[model samples]
Target: GLKGPENWGMIEELASVLGAATACSKPVSDIGWRPHSEHVGQTGKPVAANLYIAVGISGAIQHIAGINSSKVKVVINNDPEAPFFKVADYGIVGDAFDVVPRLIEKLKEFKANNA
Candidate 1:
């Protein structure tokens, strides 16, 4: 529900800075916010990344099944009771709008310090 079309740019930026591939829930693709090729879930593409970060996904069973092979899973959502948390190595309970920007800032800071 939090996958605002307006936020796509920031999301793409997040993926770029993280050196991560971008994928989305079935609904996001179904609604045409993203291409079907970018959809990942039981009914879509399966992912086996070393690290997977799911933002704003509510963790439907199908979605979890597809990403289960990921070595590490992190979930960000506003709902503390979101099912994704059950399988996540780390979970952040907050609005994506607020949490994502802060996360990006922190990552950039860490990158600068380590560089």
Candidate 2:
């Protein structure tokens, strides 16, 4: 589970760089780490994005239900048994701290090269 608000900065940065919107789990919003408007779950907002990347969020039934409409789902988590893997199009089992920064750097490099 996420320790604090500091962990979200990288996630927000990645989302910004990817031109993707950032959303959090119900627990994160409830803990005041994110606004309710940014929460995604059956009890929160529903997601229908073409690409959805979930970081450090274990899939709850409610959360999965909301994002089920997304065309593609990618999950990044340390837990190999996270339920999110069941529905994800791709899964990266690793520490978000270690993975996200590298992913952002690679995406930035790819964008620059492709541009």
Highest TM-score: give the candidate number. 2
**Tens digit per residue, CA lDDT, model 1, 1-115:** 5656778877888888899889999999999899999999999999999999999999999999999999999999999999999999999999888988899999999999999
Clashing pairs in 2: none
Off by over 4 Å in 2: none
Candidate 1 ranges beyond 4 A from true positions: none
Could you list the CA RMSD of all candidates, in the order they appear?
Answer: 0.9, 0.7
lDDT of 2 by residue, 8-111 (tens): 88988899989998999999999899999999999999999999999998999999999999999999999999999999999999999899999999999999
How many backbone clashes does every candidate have?
A: 0, 0
Instruction: Report lDDT (CA) for all predictions.
Output: 0.91, 0.93
Angstrom error of the Cα, residue 22, model 2: value is: 0.5
